[model samples]
Target: MKMRNLPPLNALKMFEAVARNSSFSLAAEELCITHSAVSHQIKLLESWMGVKLLQRHSHGATLTPAGQILFTTCVQLFNSLENCINDIQQKPINHGITLGAPSSFMANWLISRIESFEEKYPEIQIKLMTSNDFKLLENEQIDLQILSLNRQVQLKSDLVKIHLFKDKIGPVLSSEKAHNITQPSDLLTQTLLHTESNKNAWSFWATQHQVKLNEAKNQRYFDHLNLMLEAAANGLGIAIAPEILVEKQILNGQLIAPFGFTDSDAEFTLCLKQNCLKNSNLQTFIEWIQYQVSID
Candidate 1:
């Protein structure tokens, strides 16, 4: 679309700001210019159209009939331009799959193995996005997700799920903290860190081991699994997390699972929109994830 015999684009933009704000001072602040600069643009725009567009009073300014019409048009035009720019920015630069998953899973498990996937499929770029909301997948904002299913997940008809691995739960703490723990009952004496989402982690582990915890002496609750693990590593308290997620920390002696690991009802799964299966990049990611889980 072309604007023939229209005022300069910058003048129109300044006019739109002033007209919408109803104050030259506010328009100048928003446009990062002096109030005189805003007044100059408005004068230039009025001269180009040969008609006054704004009514100025000692109190403030009000849009004239012509200004009201132009303001509405400018709003729609600017909004459309913004949407176009967003669409262009989101377009993938190379053949790739955007994988969305929980922040903790990305930090603990996927970050370590991402290089291996890259080596296997150098041409296929993998974009990792941190997300846990299913709405993002439904909206097609992300290509795939790796999530732990705490209960039976009901997916939309157009989505599919692939089993990854069962979550292994246990009490993990720093090496220093583990040294004092000789038996399962000893855990009750130390501070207990709980993941806010997985409130029953300690109770489940205790029940599996046939031990009971009388209300913990000190407790800290975290919203994210990574934070809970970090606190555990710093000797703040014992945290219950999937052993698979903390395997690297355990091997490096940063933390230890003194109570051992046990299988939980929760299982990790890769979920993707059905249409994504046709894209070879996403297909490669799905298979690579399965192989990684198998070896883990």
Candidate 2:
């Protein structure tokens, strides 16, 4: 018989279990159905497929040649069905929100205050992913994304950008390591740390301040903003970083800004998918973040 002429899903399920165990009583116990129901389902499956699906012994059943083929196919079919049902029964995006952010924000800022956000919105299970810089609107795969940029992006209808906050950038090093650091030229004498995370960030700041760095001296490379901060804080080298991001460390004498700050190439913004932005959970989070984050 053709495989398409099989019995309903439930009967095929019974056939698979009975065929595998070769015991009607065990199949019944496993399926939580009576022995009669199991026997009836196997009969229906055999008849619908126009093939002998089971060999009747005095106390058990075995698969004939036709039955063996049908049983093998049904095993796969029922197993796939079971997996499909289980996947469907799982959460709606697991009742969670996935967000993307810069590593610096995660380490120095967002991570510090996430406990409050979680407590305020207990219904949501927030999941966070980080990157050195924001992804393109066309390629991003997140519910909500936090991006820091110096320029405004003119995107089409599918993308929406929200201004989050803006901060200046400058060269920061440990004040304890501030010895012999008298002037901007003295910055050349100290270890130079650069975060390659932001695109042309160091160059743009240098251009803004009329300072020319040799560029070859950028000995250290970091994939994320937090590592740059951590390295500078550990007295590994002097790093160019966001002013507000290192404010706490500066107050605690962990890091200090040796020279004045310059405007960043872009401000921190939240870029969201328009369709996902309409989700009530995400909208509430957006409003909460906008309110909590200082936009100035």
Candidate 3:
């Protein structure tokens, strides 16, 4: 058997940091090292590789073609190493699977239904992580991710995507404020709430309904959809949200969807690595979640 020759591990670590951040100074700060030390390590790496890895500019640095290739490999290697460490550290505990999803979905949809899964699979523990970063999947930080995507968009080849449910969105407001929004035009007279992540959701709905938002005078923006929905329930304004998320609020008489929901091109999807289903526990979760969505 032949041993593989590798670059200096420390130098590779510094190079990865610099490439990921696109700034030597920021990487140095994150690594708690001097800027000059970071530069030295990068130079050492470049000397060994005999290639110009980075193109420096006044603003920051950009990776060369070779650098990009190396960076990609390094990211995959590091994530695998981290996951291995985590699995070893948590082996004494119950078998755990980390699930990541958007904050709004986690709070409004999954949280209420997760207890059923936990009760059914007592030996398998679920760890909830809320993040909109899809890159986390590639980083191996989460075993599975729940994402909302337009049906037209395509994912990478190595990822496996499962259809969860159709996404239907509509304008929702407090019961007291619903009366004022009898028609689409009536929205112009009310303050429209928007989520920063999906700033164009209202526009998309308006276009589909043949309603114009150009004359809408008052509007507010929230960082999260859950916060925007809470504002609507509190009578702050009318917010456009997915029906699945606002079902409980509407059922509780806190919100009213006078216009009713319209089917959108987007749908909730479950994304995981191609090989993830090999794990029985994870496979069980996939089956259970698919069943849940099917019944819903």
Per-candidate Cα lDDT values, in order, are 0.79, 0.70, 0.83
TM-score for each model = 0.67, 0.63, 0.69
* Top candidate (TM-score): 3
RMSD of each: 17.6, 19.8, 14.9
Give the alpha carbon lDDT tens digit for every residue of 192-272 in model 2: 777666647666777776666673344577765556776888888888888767776788687888786777867888877
Q: In terms of TM-score, which candidate is stronger, 1 or 2?
A: 1
Model 3 lDDT per residue over 228-253, tens place:
87788889999999999889888979
Show where candidate 1 strays beyond 4 Å: 1-95
Clashes within 3 Å, all models in order = 0, 4, 0
RMSD of 1: 17.6
- Give the per-residue lDDT digits (tens) of candidate 1, residues 151-261: 576888998988888888999999889888998888888999998767888888888887776556777898777668878899999999988788877997888987689
Candidate 3 local Cα displacement, residue 136, angstroms: 1.1
Model 3 ranges off by over 4 Å: 1-94
What is the descending TM-score order? 3, 1, 2
